[model samples]
Target: MLQSSPKGSSSLSDNDNSSDLKSTMNDISSQTNENSDYSILPMDVIVDILSFLILSKQSINEYCNFLQSVHNKNHHSIFNLFFGYKHWDIHKTHVVFLYRNFIVKGDLTPYESRNPSEKVEQDGFIMNYIFKHAHTLTVDYCPMTDTYCQSLRKNKRIERFTFIGNRKHYHSGLCSALRECESLKKLKLDSVYDWEFTKLFELASLTYLKLNTGMMLRDFPPQKYNFDFIVDIEENQGSIKKILKNEFSESRLKHLSLISSEGFTDEYSVSNLMKLPALEILFLENQKITKQSMRTVGQSNLREICFERCLNFSDSGMEQLMKVKLPNLTKLKLSGCGFNTSNLKKVFEPSNGEILNQLTYIELSKNQNMKDTAFSKLGSFKFENLDTVDLNHCVSLSSIGILTFMRSFSECIRTLKLRECNLDETALVTILKSCSKLQRLDLEMNNISCTNIEICEITDLSNLHYLRIEKNNLTDIEWLIALPLSNLQLPRKISNYGTMQLDRQIP
Candidate 1:
């Protein structure tokens, strides 16, 4: 302790350096405090800047990306906002990324074994994030994801839901998900087999449902890939009855789209369908259900039915369909259907002493089997409320049918589309004379003769508002100047100045 030598002097020097370092640190701290005060701005000014940035398209995209990384709930909200617009390209490059993130955020993976408690915590967390404002959501073909499903549990706002199961996977979870969507009004399930259809009754608000392309095969049978499985006739009838019984008694369902699960074999299924008292619009496509079966389906509270490519539905079905009293029905479409002259005739025939008096619209395009007889049948009915009718590609039909059909309903019918119908000079003259109240007419690709004499006679269309007379052998159309038609659709042709004064041409 008393030694005062060179070593002791070095120790004292070290202590002095340590004190200098501490003083320098204190000075740096004081400088940092001054800089922080300078950087501070008013909260309102900061908020204004944030608002401007948030509203910018680029900013919204960036925020969504950032939010996706931090919270699933925020990501779902941002995703919905971005999709709300009709067109948005921000997610094009990052679609796969977004898909992956949706899976991770929802933790919606398939079950290792069936039990609710297995991933309850993860499912709840995912549900909390996804259920905020998504009224419609699709859970399609993502085999490993089941996390997002639980988020839908007890959600009050979801009205529409779609689930598409993978070919090899089980769709038990989809059934589970449906039970939770209590507010669901419209539902579509694709590629699901043996679905307990009765379970849908729990969704009391459901009004529309589409079931397409399901299978019961143990493996991917190549031939049956696009096919659906059929339930036993008794079971199918019971299920349909249950659907009708519960649907009207408990719920407010009005519209239903039933894509056939398979070719319906049960007469009971057909019979039970008519009991749905609340059903209004039914869209049946790609079905094997025949006209006989349709009578029962039509007997239900259905008003309108759209038939497309259901091959078995021939003229017989049309008769039965017409027999069904649809007081509120306004529209019917038979596009691409196999209807012939017999069915076409029924369309104009007065159902029960008065043409479906409430029927205002009818579309029967591409029924190549229709002809003059069909037109004559139409002349018998009074389409007092009819406004629009389309007979496009009815190639077998000639002018005789066209002339009479137009004359019969010309008083009420304003719009007529007869594209590609086989027409001649006689038919054209008859239509011009009969359709005085016609506002729109399409005679495209027809065989109507275009002689100067015939063209002169065409001036009678004074009430015509829209006219299409394209793809016919016409060298002159001088007679068209009589009407105040605002729209004219005609094919390009070299017309002499004497032919007609060209006001406006739309091809």
Candidate 2:
């Protein structure tokens, strides 16, 4: 056992701190017997451990807020009010520790007033120590003003960079500074245009890229005729493909999230991404995808793919993609799409009389066309590997489909979501009785019309902790009251039925 050393004054210098540390180690050494394993520790090993602790930049209480008022948020706010958002005030002789992240939100402060270079280089930081230590930098709602541009010019250690701003930020200096980040690896930007896309070509280490808000927006959107939306499919296919190929030519980008209405057309743009040697996880959200687009996806080597709210990816489209046998795919989320029972049957039963046996998690939510037939072909395949199943908002599914799925994967499935699916009393009863191993159960908006529910004595929902039966009409509380609910999360709507507490632990 080690003994506590006497507390040193906060004004202790580096030499004093080192002396105190050595004294503490000597005390430990003195207490340990020759037979003790700790007594055999090499002096070099002890020094190395202490060195790592000092170098890791972990802010303990003393390191974070020890002696100075510099660590106080109010002091920083007061300083920001007078001058600008900044770190240490060196004129006050305040010693500051290393910071892991630096964020700038432009909404609170006016863009024009502050000179960020003066704040970063002169008043606040000494030798740009703060930026040197910070690895992650987030610039949200901030345009490419000269202030931030000059500030970011000194960001040599930042690895993950996120910039969320509108399309109006058009400063060439800002663009050049971001493009020249030699240490940058992951980037998430919003409202990227054709001109902005070219700025990313210089980043050689970028791996994860997520560009939101329609990357290819046409300049002159056509007048309202058949639809009021801007269409860029035919005009920007080649433009998008050319930019992507050039941008990622030498880059080893792995995870990519791109908008896919006109962004993914015929095998032109998405196929370009597949050519990337390390590209794996892809997110294509909220678009009208065609068979040609699906064809490109089916042939890719993506480990995980999500097609959320792509209405044109119908039953036929999903079936064709599934038949191709993507051995690399482990997680497939086709939520809010057009897939239903008929085509989704291939997902539940395939690969030598078993289901898509490789999939660990499959989400088929918001498919209103799903019915009893969707689960009709489900076999007792090795579903032990499948952990989560989400069929939320499939209102067309009756008790038959719900029952079939629950009976098949009750023992294996840990998280089951069937919210807004219009479940009745029989479905409710079956769920509690069958899905005993469920850790999370979401039966929200089901409105099971049961004024008096019979709590089944034999039901084994012992493992269930999270329950979201919100906006439901199951009035009976005896069944819920009987379970071993140590930390059960009940919906506020369920409390209206009886004297039940809504707040358990914000699940």
Candidate 3:
């Protein structure tokens, strides 16, 4: 049933040569002593063996020994097929050359060496090869030198680029190199800063952008912090707002993620993001954003939105968001956002529970204030298309609230997570009987006891493929053997019972 592409096709002449190579290999294997001459083998056979060795992640000593017999031209061909720009059409192919590893053991010199001239020559070759053909590249903790930058400018075909570095090293030339990548579509920069954001706007083809400042303010004690750092953060926030408003207004960016950028305050930075017409996915984490900024985000055409650790976002702002009419919204996550049930009800059944009808995925985990009354009100609404619900760490939700919520979406819910919720055995039984179509369920760290009644109820989950009940007070798991589960995770204490039951059922 697997289809082949034109690039994968082999010519008739190549196949005949491969057959001859196979016979030669068989004759060599039958000989008493190993043969060092591999010249009789066809190019396809050598390439196939090398590909197999790399794909299997096995040691290539045998192949390396065989390559010694190959001619220089054939060696270049084999390397091209294995690691060079020969097969650009293969989307899954990626060439990752770590600077530290490359400098120590370049492609030609696979082993370590002490000669400085040889190291320099191999490094040059690696850089040239990557610049000429690599479409995707990831450099780790490597300082971008002037030569590297110049080489990057010539490589306009790079579609994905990731640069990971430390705070001590600053790559000043990265900005200029990025501007030259006209074909770039995705870029991730970590621990890099002070680059002209306006240059990004020139990349009209960019669709995904991620920038992590990598500064953990929490690590430093309050008294040890310098006042200038805070001032610089505020300044960066203003500059980011200006760049977004001026440069990204007409860009074709669809996904934008900003992490640990403390300068991204509510008024200027978040508000400017709303002006991006082509944006659809937005992720904000560890930033200061208020409810007022939510108003601008609600008006945007974003179909997926995630807000994590945005302490300024309160219930009132959520109310404003729920009131907005977003026809295309489908996914929403508010993890670690200390909003209570009253605000959540507004989000679920906002504006008479009519808006966000297309919403299928909802995550309200770590909201300690979500209680029974909230679910009681939530159950009253009709989310006929709801698919996944995550209420993990909502410790205030008791059996009553959980039962009410489960019953509401029992018909359509396919995945449900209630980890660390205050659900008892009765609540677990109710969920089992209600969510008949549930395929994945996570009820870890609860008070549920796996009694006979609970086991009987679990047997009814015919469609369940994954079940996690770890850290619960499960005592009886003998009946778990009857369930048709592809994956199951039970508490450590009850794992012995599960193992014994499986052993008895196996043969």
Index of the highest-TM-score prediction: 3
User: What tens digits encode model 2's per-residue C-alpha lDDT throughout 1-507?
Assistant: 111122332233544475464454345435443453332445664443233222211122223232133433232211222123223322222222223454544443222325677544543332233333347766666555565566577787678877777667544475577776778888887655444444554477878877655444353132211111212223364543222334445667788776633543222334445556577787777654544555544355677878787777777667766755466877888887877676667656635333265667888888888787877676665466677888899989877788877676777788888888777766777777776677777777876755445565444655766777667765676666665565665565643752333335435
Sorting all predicted structures by TM-score, with the top scorer first, yields: 3, 2, 1
Q: Estimate each model's TM-score.
A: 0.63, 0.66, 0.70
Best by lDDT: 3
Q: Sorted on lDDT, highest at the top, how do the candidates line up? A: 3, 2, 1
In candidate 1, what are the lDDT values of residues 141-249, reduced to their tens digit?
5442354445556566777776666555444565676677777888877655554544664567888877654543233342232111212123564553233333346
Quote model 3's TM-score. Answer: 0.70
Instruction: Report the lDDT of model 1 for residue 115.
Output: 53
Backbone steric clashes in candidate 3, count: 0
RMSD in angstroms, candidate 2? 11.1
lDDT at 374, model 3: 68
